[model samples]
Target chain A: GAGVSQTPSNKVTEKGKYVELRCDPISGHTALYWYRQSLGQGPEFLIYFQGTGAADDSGLPNDRFFAVRPEGSVSTLKIQRTERGDSAVYLCASSLGGGRRPYEQYFGPGTRLTVT
Target chain B: GQQVMQIPQYQHVQEGEDFTTYCNSSTTLSNIQWYKQRPGGHPVFLIQLVKSGEVKKQKRLTFQFGEAKKNSSLHITATQTTDVGTYFCAGEGGGTSYGKLTFGQGTILTVHP
Candidate 1:
């Protein structure tokens, strides 16, 4: 669409439940990123995508967290066996693919996930 | 592990007062970008500094990149109630891995009316 968009705005799930958060990036943006923000902290990088491929997933905290952008436009972040520690805001951003200027990142209204 | 640290975690300023925040990187940065996130809102991009000792301004907001490329600052000349938000400085380390930014702990600014 016009800007990065995320779905469900908020999600509250119980421990051991699986949850999914979705993000739809700006049209024609080939670079996408996901981040997590805990209380009183800045967003932390979780993964980055170049097209449909994850160029970097080093920031994923554990195997329980995973994300995919199969079509390079819409992406999903999945959490398995959600824990209270996983409660945070999930953010999505997009930018024009690799070039001399990787300066700006358009972000979405993040999804607040609360694991009880 | 290449982190960014910000000082003065919280600041309260009266409307029309000036506010400033500092960011320091564990390593030299290839570039620095600033963003603002209002309470309960997502972050919005502000500006980026690429050249050493570079300074830029947007209205009352001034941004500076240090000559060492290891630190940066954001100064709001005349803060307004609308300027109340958390300001963050993200650093891109010098290398191919520099494309992805590592953000500093943000400074939450509260502007009193």
Candidate 2:
């Protein structure tokens, strides 16, 4: 079976431009997550989706950052008026959700977004 | 908000040496997961510890959960060049945030052969 995957391995855009990063989760995975990682740091939680609804979006930095999993399989992270500080690796992960405890997560290759 | 803190942001060891990284969380965690990421790759799941004061081993790697469920550690014996990468500890709050993970700053390990 194929693992999780993300498109646009690399993206460079102007600081004020809008950008969308896509993620395709593994088949049958009910839980999807989005995280942002800065250089020399750990991944920061951005949002999480169970089915078509976002279970947690508290990690989103601001209103400019939004994500949606319309079909409950693929997710798109949108950034409006991207800033240089938003330059980082955007990672997506998926797992078997709806358990007493959380399950292990399988991560994607990630999309490196560089705001120039 | 929960925060996971890792110790020794960077470590350098010889191929045959031992390496260890510790993680502490601001709040009690239901479970802790370890992940390894190569220099240019994404994170790969290593292990998960759920029980308090639990210990699990995989080959030369050993993972231990704290007695309080708020801390954990990962130790590698006889480090190999293949172990060169960043190690991250992710904590799950286990309540309404069950699927959401709070990750540590990560520990970067470099092994010289």
Docking class of 2: medium
Off by over 4 Å in 2: none
User: Which parts of model 1 are misplaced by more than 4 Å?
Assistant: none
For model 2 chain A, the run of ten residues with the poorest summed lDDT: A95-104
Which residue pairs does candidate 2 place in steric collision? none
Q: Assess chain B of each prediction and give its TM-score.
A: 0.97, 0.99
- What DockQ results for candidate 1? 0.65
Give per-residue lDDT, candidate 2, residue B36: 97
Q: Which run of 10 residues does model 2 chain B get worst, by summed lDDT?
A: B93-102
Clashing pairs in 1: none
**lDDT by residue (tens digit), candidate 2, A1-116:** 89999999999999899999999999999999999999998999999999999988999999999999999999999999999999999999999884466688999999999999
| lDDT string, candidate 2, B1-113, tens digits | 89899998999999999999999999999999999999999999999999999999999999999999999999999999999999999999887778888899999999999
**i-RMS values of the candidates, in order?**
1.6, 1.3
Cα RMSD to the true fold for all candidates:
1.3, 1.0
